[model samples]
Target: MKSSVRAVLGLAGGALAGLALMAASASAQTIAITDGRILTGSGIIENGTVIIRDGRIAAVGASVPVPAGAEVISAAGRVVAPGFVAVDSGLGGNEVSSQPEANDLRQSSNSISAAFDLSWGLDPWSITLPVARLGGVTRAIVVPSHPGSSGGHDHNHDFAGLGASGHHEPGLFAGQAAVIHLAEGTEIIVQPRVAMVAPFGNAGANVAGGARGALYTLLRETFAEVRLYARNRAAYDRGDVRALSLSRADLEALVPVVEGRMPLIVTVHKANDILMALRIAREENIRLILDGAEEGWMVADQIAAANVPVLLNALANLPGSFERRASSLENAARLHAAGVLIAIKGNEGSVHRAREARYNAGNAVAHGLPYEAGIAALTVNPARIFGQQQRFGAIAPGLEADVVIWSGDPLEPLSQPVAIYIRGVAQPLYSRGLELRDRYRPGQQPGLPPAYRN
Candidate 1:
């Protein structure tokens, strides 16, 4: 009886091991898309075959051959393009803007500005991600709305002789931004501290003593302090250094910005303000990315000369504020014509509706931007701006397989993504909204009340 039991146990263990091997083999399977209208970002291929292996593109050409045992997808009448990369997205940071528990985009009353990392607040399972993925957005650059609350807080406390008042104001430095992948599952953050968000222009001026000049003064002074903090960290930590306006944490965060290692995403709109940001970038010798450049078209030449990239909302054609009086639908077209690198911003400030960035690119196209340039703005431009171009921006050989098969012209309002592959793995075209719609359809009836139904 004991011998028979041992034999059965051995067989069971062997069966489990075989199943595990099978699962591993399935996960490593190659994927191929054949006969698709491939937009390679650099150019277009009428009909090509893209082969993906080990989560990267192995081959891409008109006559590329698919390997044996590979899962093949026919895109004969579809559009195959690189996945969209959205900027200024609030994905994984907030679900509902008004709900405090679900929102993590801002940190009001926190003494730690610049040092606050948004990646800590990321929720991999955020409902908005699936919806964005369905729209072909595979990556994003997430930023904070602002750091401090509208109402100022008292910061009279000191850390190692660091002054709590004046230049150490809360709203000066919003916080660190992050780059993320919209893929499902636990691993979502691609790079933390990708950029430091600094609010500028009208609202920022209000925070800095109600004058734009005052904000620039604070920026200069803050950078000086950052240099001092970096040069004498031991003295500062020991409380032997002179009093500074910022906390130790904030100072540490600005070290990268001052040293030119991290780019600063300055939120400015007016043409003058855009020039001012460029001036500061030169003066401080730091990299800069201009966001919300409503009047960027006016300074297209200057911006292009400086070789700085702009992130914009193509639909921002209205003069919503004094700083945006020069806003135009052709802002993107004018900038692109001047050789400026630009990326499109989403319609929703947060990740909930970030998919609308695709349509924004379409609007730009209608307003004189080239069709190919519009696609590049939605994909390669953002990835390049955030130092992610080499990984998955374009549909090229050796790039990550973040490819999308579209039903038609992707920029068209009615077109949809037929399939999405992130890291060479097929993603489910599912969203919570779809489930809710199906559950509450006109003809559907439930045994229980709507709220009580599972």
Candidate 2:
């Protein structure tokens, strides 16, 4: 009897495994997008074809032959572009702002600083991810926030710590940021520890001491300690090295930054603070990406000269603080005009509002940014910024097949995606909200409850 039961169970397991393999094979099938207004890295193709095979773009041009038995998706009379990339997103971490346990974007009671990786507890199954994906955001750079940061889901808010909480220990650095594909599955992390986030300007000042000078001094000292710890790890482990402000794990995390292997994303808004961050990057010989640079337009020439990219909310125009007194809606346009690489965030990096980023890009175009550059800001620019240009930035050959076919102009507020593909696999545009709307809509069957109607 035992042998008979085991045989039945074995057959069932094998059948399940075979089904999984079949599903994967279907996802990897060749798909050809035909006759679309293709947006490529080089330029736009009025009528072109993109052939996707095995989860990668096989060929893209004006005339590409589709393979036999390949799935044909007609994008005629539509705009076909690379999926949008949302930077400094809180997705996969902050599901609900009110649910503290659900929000993994900040570690309020932790001893670690730079070593606090956001990818450790990322929840790829978060309901908010599908909504963002529905808005054509196939990729995102998920960043952790400081303990005392405000503005709810907004990444443009101040990233300052409350400084020495009695209940918990907070560190100078917020944490590491990660890049993730907004596709379904547990393995969503494209790159972990892509950048080290540090508070700068007012936020840094509050965390370090009461002044900006103290903040810079503390950073230099901390970096120096990182070098020392890296050079004499054995001695430090033996307690023979000098005492350091940050923990050993933090030092290890910053080694990549100090060694120029990773970029340090500093949250600074003021023009002078932006220059200071630039100077520090130059002095320390580290790569820099400015985040929340609300006043970056004021010193656009300097930022352009340094070739540092600026990430900001395109709609940030009001003087929210003294640092952003010179904020303007044209900040993105001016920065792009000054020859600086810029990535615009919509809804201030709100996870639930990520779809608004395309609208923000449209607004940027309305405020003097070129139309082509606006699209680049959402797609190729962010990918290049984080060293994923060859992986999935553009609708180019050999890149991951992350494409979006829009019903109309993608930048327009009324435009929507008719079909979306991520890594060659078609994704459903449905979300929990849409499900509820359909379930509880008028004219639904009255015999069953809304939950049972579906």
Candidate 3:
């Protein structure tokens, strides 16, 4: 009798598992976007068609034949482009500011710990996701905030701490960054950790004895130690007889960074910080990318000569910091004209700013940057930086189907993505901001009374 009951339970479980598999299979269907003004992002395509099957772009061209019975989105008179990639923004997994437990971004007190992964900090359901998505941002490099010692100071130990200890510690935020696809499920969308971040600007100086010299010294010493660590890794791994007892956490955390496997993303706004960062990059033979380069226009030639790309905020024309004295609305265009590969980032620390990414790109075009290049900066350039160009950047064959259909030119202020695709699946455009507008503003649908519709 016991065996009979056990057999019945096993059969029921199997049936449920089979049903789940079927449901998943049904969700993964072939979709094709037809009859659109497709901006392939390699360039423009007039009245083009994109065929997607099983979440990958099957074909993209004016003459590509559409398959029968395929789900088609008629995008006539609409603009289609590869979804935008926000290089630097605090989007997903960073809600609930008062709750430090909810924010998983920065680490304080120490410097070196590369094993800290940012994927664990990501909140797949954050309200910020839809806000960015509505503006056509489909992927982002979710970076951690700078550790308290921004200028390369050692507050406690050199390497911040072990990943296990940092992961469990409370009230401290500092760790690694992870790339994420702005998709629904948290489990399947995480990309690999691509870079290790270091704060190297005025903030870094504040943390390092209020001196730029201290920050530079600390950074140099940290990298030197990392170089030694890499040289001795095999010996340490093998438990060699003369393995040195080194507890340098900063150096240890930079093993991947020093080897060029991971790029070092430095936060710097001033020309001096940019030059200093360039010196470090050349001296260490390490890969580097500059973030928050508000004054990058001042030394565009130098940056381009060094082959270091920049991520800049397009709408931040107000002079907030001394380093950004030359900050202008046309900074993006100027940098592009100087041959610097530009990636336009929305303003950090606020959700409202992210919604203006398209406007930011448009402003760049209005100044001097070509319209196509401006669009590519927001889309392909960022994807290339994050190492997802093949999958996420352009509308090409065999790429993930992350396409945005805009009501008009994407850069225009009134433009909005009417339809957005994430891995060939349609996503809802509803967000907290939109919901509030519907609830409070008088007029459409179930809003306030007719008298308030004015």
Instruction: Give each model's clash number.
Output: 0, 0, 15
Q: What is the TM-score of each candidate against the true structure?
A: 0.89, 0.90, 0.82
Query: Cα RMSDs of all predictions?
Result: 8.7, 8.3, 10.3
List the pairs of residues colliding in candidate 2.
none
Q: How would you encode candidate 3's per-residue C-alpha lDDT over 205-313 as one tens digit per residue? A: 6544457887787667656756767787776567662432224454465687878888888778888889999998999888989887878888889999999888877
Model 1 vs. true fold: TM: 0.89
Model 2 misses residue 309 by how many Å? 0.8
lDDT of 2: 0.80
**lDDT of each prediction vs. the true structure?**
0.80, 0.80, 0.69
On TM-score, the candidate that comes out on top is 2
Residue pairs clashing, model 1? none
- Misplaced by over 4 Å in model 2 are 1-28, 147-169, 450-454
| Residue range 1-454, candidate 1, lDDT tens digits | 1111011112224334323323432455677778889987767898898888888989999999778767666777778999999898888888976676787877754467788898999899999899898788998888876622211112332111222454455558788889899876898999999999877887667667768898899899989999999999999989999998777888999999999999999888989989999999998898999988989999999999999999999999998778899899999999999999999978767477789999999999999999999999999888899998889889898898889878788899887876777887767666899778868767677785877445
lDDT per residue for candidate 2 within 146-169, as digits (tens), equals: 722322432332333443532113
